[model samples]
Target chain A: MGKLYVIGIGPGSIENMTLRAKEAIEKSDIIVGYTKYVDLIKTLAKGKEIFSTGMKGEEERCKEALRLSKDNIVSIISTGDAGIYGMAGLILELKDGEDVEVIPGITASSAAASVLGAPIMHDNCNISLSDLMTPYELIKKRIEMAAEGDFVISLYNPKSKGRPHYLRESLETIKKYRAGNTPVAVVKHALRDGQDVKLFNLDSFDDSQVDMMCIVIIGNSQSYIKQGEFITPRGYKL
Target chain B: MGKLYVIGIGPGSIENMTLRAKEAIEKSDIIVGYTKYVDLIKTLAKGKEIFSTGMKGEEERCKEALRLSKDNIVSIISTGDAGIYGMAGLILELKDGEDVEVIPGITASSAAASVLGAPIMHDNCNISLSDLMTPYELIKKRIEMAAEGDFVISLYNPKSKGRPHYLRESLETIKKYRAGNTPVAVVKHALRDGQDVKLFNLDSFDDSQVDMMCIVIIGNSQSYIKQGEFITPRGYKL
Candidate 1:
């Protein structure tokens, strides 16, 4: 079997992609990813056997990558880091003895946090609100625990058409443990086209501003807004 | 004012760095970072002026970067992603007005995770074991809460000269909420020279194997070891 490289393309921005990700794509005989994510980098992977599918086609894509890797060098791509809510797990689970390499890239948490200043400078938790496969009760429990931990929390898949109220409900659980003045930032399409970033406090943030593409970050108790940018101090005495 | 690019060099590997990070360094007239981190990329910015300091010199570097950015393009570097336990927060806090662009890179959490398979493929929490800035009590609380949430826990700054037992104590807290057979990955200097990756059960992992340079990733409830690789499933049926 040939080598299989599971790569992270990094938030749809060409510059956000790591050198390793570019190199894997360059060395690959086949490139695979979700259609939208692949569309972001298809131009760069020209002359390769490109395989992409729409959302909910992860199993299909992972299987294809595994089959193609039997005799060909293949690169399976994911947006952001391939390990964090990406395709690495699925790909690894499906292939037993394939020589696979997981090339890490810039994750969405850091990408969104960087745009809204340094909101995640300290201990942080990333919880996805999408309950597609996970139960809603477990998701709520995770959010509650994260809030109780006083962690800088990054909420992934904040809002979706199927679960529009999940973000608000998650915030309500967070509000029970945090002060209303806690800083919150909702970033849509971070580092991608049609990017929208807005800052507000826990009580004042407009939930309607968020969507499936948005990432909402709520600050810890010590985090505060300075110079119109949200930041969590790393125990600095400045 | 000239642009201040606070860049993440990504786990000390040139290939792990993002294109934006490399570009910022290439465009910089002055480069600054912690001595260890600056040494990783000094050759890349050969013609540029460089300023680096030992540990506990963050405030001085941030101020210098700010002052220098007023006239010349300055790039302040950090190992891994600058936004996560790196230099971006301090730089944003010290500078009142400056064109600062935070270029994200692969954080150590993901870098270590990638080396040990997909241990953090689910909701995860990152808590530093170092008490130089954060109190040990708070760090312990964060670990307990993360365990209660069943998050794939990534313990950063796991061990140091001052507190060698912190990792064991933190694991004790996690053990209270998890099974002793929970998968764990101990990665030292991931993606850099002398990289060491090891796997063990939560009950069997040796404390002596860990240090401040190591990252310990504890798998969540749904995670397991397959084909000698740790993986947290993404709710896939197969």
Candidate 2:
């Protein structure tokens, strides 16, 4: 039996990927991922068999990776960390006899947080606005609770072409518990090409600025913008 | 002025460090970090001037790094992601005339999540139990809200010899909202020497097993344990 490595390439930048993830990809005979994610690792995928599918084809991709891992060292890549909305869970569920190793990668939240300054220095929560797998009501409740708790919130898949109101709705829900002046940031394509970061207060936030490729960070009440940098202090007295 | 790189070395393992972080360290004239963090990157700091201080010396270390950056390229290292309870905020705050760049790293939550399956596949919250900086009441409130929101909870500094009851208190609070069967995993020294991973249910969890070095992940109600892996699915099927 061959080993199956589920790797997170880390925010679309080859420089952000860990040595372990890079080594796994380099050593794998076959690399499998979503087409976009496979394209991110094209340099490492050289001389290797590449298998990729389009969006919403995660199940097929995992099945294929598992099948290939039965006799070959296969690497299944996820854009961010493999364990977070990545292929680790599905592959683990479907792998019947193969040995699997999950190589962790830097997550999108951390990548975006790095770009946006220390907005996540304290307790923080991450919620996805995509209603594909989760109910809208549940996500709303989570947002409300997170706001009430004063946790810095990171919204993933906040806006897509099909779902335009989710980010707006999420912000509205947050506004009920958080002050209108709460600092927020939209990081598009963090650590990747065409990277753009914009800062806004809750009242001034424009949902149209976000899309599927962005990670939206909503700061806690204590979060502040300093010299154009979004920072949530680590409770240190300055 | 020379450049200052605030780098997250990533969960104690050199293999987990990003290429960017490694390169920044290699090119740095001096490396400054907490003593323990400095030890983690000793291999990369070979023959380089290293300035390390004991715990709670973050401010002094940041000041020293900033002072050194005025004349020499300096790398201030932090375990896990520099932005998450690491040195990025401190360095940024202390930097007056220097150019400081924060290089993101793999956080402990993501590292532990990979080891214990995909517990953070959806919304999650990270809370630290250490009361040195944050008030105990605020920590309790965040824990309560995170539990009420059903966010997968990752507890940093969950326990220490000095504060043994925090983990127990946190679990008791979480039990009010989540079921006793909710899966929890404690990962200590992830990806480094003497790494240990422990799986338990909420009811069966032992607080004595945890320490400051461990990251305790409590899954949401939707999470399940399959084949010894704790997986919180991405709600793909409902």
Candidate 3:
């Protein structure tokens, strides 16, 4: 039986890829991923057989990868951490008997936190606004609870052209529980080319600034902005 | 003015450290961190001035690193991601006017998730059980809310010799809202030399297996264990 490796490439930057992840890709005979992710590592896929799928084709992609893993080493790639909104779960669920290993990578939340000061230094919650797999009501409830608990919150897939109001609605729900002065950060393409980081207060945050690629971080009650950096204290008594 | 880079070395493995993190450490004239983390990267700190402190000495270490940054390029290292339960916040809080940059690394949650299968493939909450800085009441509240929200939960600093019952207490609180058969995974020293991964159900989980170095992940309602792997579904049609 052949082994399969689900690798998180870490925010589309070759520099961010862990040595283990890069080595797995190098050792694999077949490379499988969404087309965009495949393009991100195209230089490394030079001699490997590539199976690239489009968005919304995760199920088919996992099935294909598992089938290919029956007799050949396969490397399936995800942009950020494979276990976080990535293909690890789907592949595990679809695999019949193939040996699989998941190599973790730097997730966008941590990557964005690095870019925009330390906004997640304390307890935090990560929620994806994409209703494709989760219900909107459940997402709203999670957001409200996160706000009430005063947890630093990271929102993924916050907005797209089709679901433009989700980010605004989620922010409104958070505003109902959190103060309007709460510091907010929007980081796009973190650690990659054309990276952008923006800071705003909950009251002044603009929905137009976010998209599917951006990570939106809303600070907890104790979070503050200093010297243009957003930071949440780790509850340490200074 | 000198520059200070707070780098997360990613679970104490040279292979897990990002290229950027390694570059930052290599470019530094002084390296500062907790003694254990400093030891993990000791080979890289060969000719550089290394300043390390024991546990509970974070304040002094950060202050010393900041002081060194006045005339030297200093790299203050942390295990896992520096933005999560790491030294980035403390350094940012203590910075008066030094040029500081936080380079992200793979966090323990992602590393543990990778080892224990995809338990955090959806919305999740990370709460630290250590009450050294946070109030126990707040920690309990976060655990309760995370349970009620059915969010995949990662417990950091779950237990130590000084605080043995915190993990048990936190699990009990989760039991109040979650099913007893909920999948739970404990990963210790993830990606390190003595790595260990354990899987259990909520009712069968043993607290003695955890320590300060362990990360405990509690799966949501839809999570299940198959073939010794703990996985949470991404709410897909499959």
Q: Point out the worst 10-residue segment of candidate 1 chain B by lDDT.
A: B39-48
The TM-score of candidate 2 is 0.98
- Residue B213 local lDDT, model 2: 88
Show how many residue pairs clash in every candidate, following the order shown: 0, 0, 0
Model 3 CA deviation exceeding 4 Å by range: none
Error of 2 at A104 (Å): 0.6
Residue A208's lDDT in candidate 3: 82
Q: Model 1: how far is B47 from its true place, Å? A: 2.9
Quote model 2's TM-score for chain B.
Answer: 0.98
CA displacement after TM-score superposition, residue A147 of candidate 3 (Å): 1.2
Candidate 3 has which clashing residue pairs, if any? none
Worst 10-residue lDDT window, candidate 3 chain B: B160-169
- For candidate 3, give the docking quality class from DockQ: high
Query: What share of the reference contacts is kept in model 1?
Result: 0.88
Tens-digit lDDT track of model 3 for B159-237: 9887788889889988998999999888999989999988889999997878889999999999999888889999888
Alpha-carbon shift of residue B4 in model 3 (angstroms): 1.4
Q: Any idea what lDDT model 3 has?
A: 0.91
> Per-residue lDDT tens digits of candidate 2, residues B1-238?
7999999999988899999999999999999998888888888999999999998988999899999999999999989999998888877666576888889999999989988878888789989999999889999999999999899999999988877888899999999999899999999998889989999999999877688889999999989899899998886651
